[model samples]
Structures are given as C-alpha cells and as structure tokens.
Target: MTETTPYDADRARFTRQALARLVLCDHAVDVADGAAGLVATENDPDSGPGGRVSQAFQLIELAERALASAVIYEREQGSSWAEIAQYLGIGPAQAEERFAANLEGWNTAFDVPYRLDETGRKRIPQLPTAAYDPAWACEKLDRWAYVQRIGIDAVSSGLVMAVPEEELPSVTP
Candidate 1:
C-alpha cells in the first residue's frame, strides 16, 4: 500500500491561490494599459472631439481596476524609480512624482512581501528576459511599443496580463 502525504493538500491549495492571485494581478495591469490608450487617443490633437472623448471616458471606466492593480503589482515587485520611469517612457523624476503617492498607498494596502539582502537593499524578482516563443515575442513587442507611445501607465497596466499562456506553444506527439 502507498502512503498518501497530508502535505499534498496544503500544497495544492497554496498553488491554486497563487495562480488566482497572479491572474487577478495580470488582469488589473491589462485594464490599466487599455484605459491609458483610450485617454491618449481622446487627447490626440488630430482626433475628432466627439467619438474620441466618448471612447476615452469608456476606457477610463473599464481600466480603473487595471490601473489600480498595476500600481499594486509594481509596488510589490519593488520596481525602482528608474525602471518605473523607463516603463512609463518619462523622466525618472516625473514618474516618481506622478506615481509615488499612489504606489506607496497601494503597496501598504496589499501587504506585498519584500526581500532584503545582506547589504540591506530591498530586492525584487527579475522578470524573465527570454520569450517562450518567437512569434509571441514579436507580437508583444509591437503591443508594448504601441502602448508605450500612449504612456507608461499603459505599459505598466499592460504588463500585468501581458504574459501569454500560449507563449510556450504546447506540442503533442
């Protein structure tokens, strides 16, 4: 007879919770990015006033949760000012000024964990640099560029759910 480990149930539950958390976080980011784009198009000098304004308002309503989520995730991820600025495509000072208050409050609310090294510097997990698939990478690059042109808020928000599950392109033999 094989013995079943009781620890397995706890592990499975933890995994599920973790996956759910990640999914929610990602969803938030995506919404925020979408909202930022709508705002930009509405603000565009060349865009006609009527349709663009309505679209922007609609996007804002749709993206509030996403923007909140991105702020929370970035704070938890311990993103540096420079990194955040780069993500926003703005000067570091501007990024900090724009996001610092919101980011701080969001981080505190989420109780996101942080690590401190021997040097007492806080550390964040590095995002994977390699794409799971070349095609997915190309698509992501294009999407990122487009979002980036609108604002960093869009980029940050987009990043929340930007990881595609199909990137690995499962193979069956």
Candidate 2:
C-alpha cells in the first residue's frame, strides 16, 4: 500500500488491524521480491517464462483485500467514518460507502463463524484467514516484530492470565 497502515498499540497487540498490517507488509515484500526476480531474469535469455510479472500483478488483489481487512479492523476498533476517511482522502460518506459492505461482512462473520464446505463435511471459516486463525497470525507477526525490533519479546503476546491462589504450591524454604 502507498499509504501507511494502522496497527494497534501493545495493549491491543495482535488485534485484527495489526494482523492485517502484517499481511499488507507481507504483500509488499512479495511485490519487491517478484520485481527483483524479474530484474534478475531480464538479461538472461535462458531464464524464460517464470511468471514473475504475474506474481507481482496478483499482489495488487491481495493488497486490496488486506486494505479492506484494515478498514474493517479500524471500524471494529470504533474509529468513526470521518477519521478513516481523512487518511483515505475521501469524504466520510464516500469512505463509509466504500467500506460499509466489508464492515457488515466482518460483523456477520463473528455471528456465524463458519460454514459448511462443498463436501458438507469440511468447515470453512467466515472470518478473514489471519483473524480466524489468530495463533498462527501471532506467531508470524511476533517473529516479524522481533526482527524489526530486538528484545520486544512479542512471543509473549496477549494479556497474562493469573493463576488461582489456592492452586499455588507451598512456599516454605
């Protein structure tokens, strides 16, 4: 994306927006990598028909999906249409019109988490893949975070749960 994507604060670490941002970044890297490969093969006549251009083209669609996810996340986080519109450079009504269906679908997904696949045996998640499988997203984003800033220890993401006092072992020395 040409514009900066929003991510949640540490207190809301690994929120949908954060995961969507991670996906957006991943798409960007993919685009860069495909471009590099295209460059590398430019002079080589023997390296023919690798479909690198196709791969990069596909990234645009993925980036759009990622952007929609970001919008949905922003709405979910209680950002008003005007606030989201400012960054998008459109009027609030326009912004809301563009993203309202996405927001609706996002909300509906939670109400109906999954649907039956064509086979009727397999289940297909209604939620976006990253948000649907949050543990995987956390692991991936955590590593990305660690590489970007050492010692953050994003591996320990999410609020810590307290153990029951009665379950504690005896502390006699």
Instruction: Give per-model TM-scores.
Output: 0.34, 0.58
For candidate 2, the 10 contiguous residues with the lowest summed lDDT are 1-10
Q: What number of backbone clashes does candidate 2 have, counting pairs of residues 3 or more apart or in separate chains?
A: 0
List the candidate 2 regions with Cα displacement exceeding 4 Å: 1-52, 144-173
| Deviation from native of the Cα of residue 95 in model 2, angstroms | 1.2
lDDT of 1 at 14: 38
State the lDDT of candidate 1 residue by residue for 30-147, as single tens digits.
5655665554422355556576567667677656545544544555566676876787788879877876765565444224323346786544322111111223334555576576
On residues 1-173, what C-alpha lDDT tens digit does candidate 2 reach at each position? 12211221221356656545554555444454455444443344443575655666776766676677667767766789999999999999999999889888877865666777898766676766556655665577667656655444322333243765578788998
Candidate 2: residue 112 lDDT (0-100)? 67
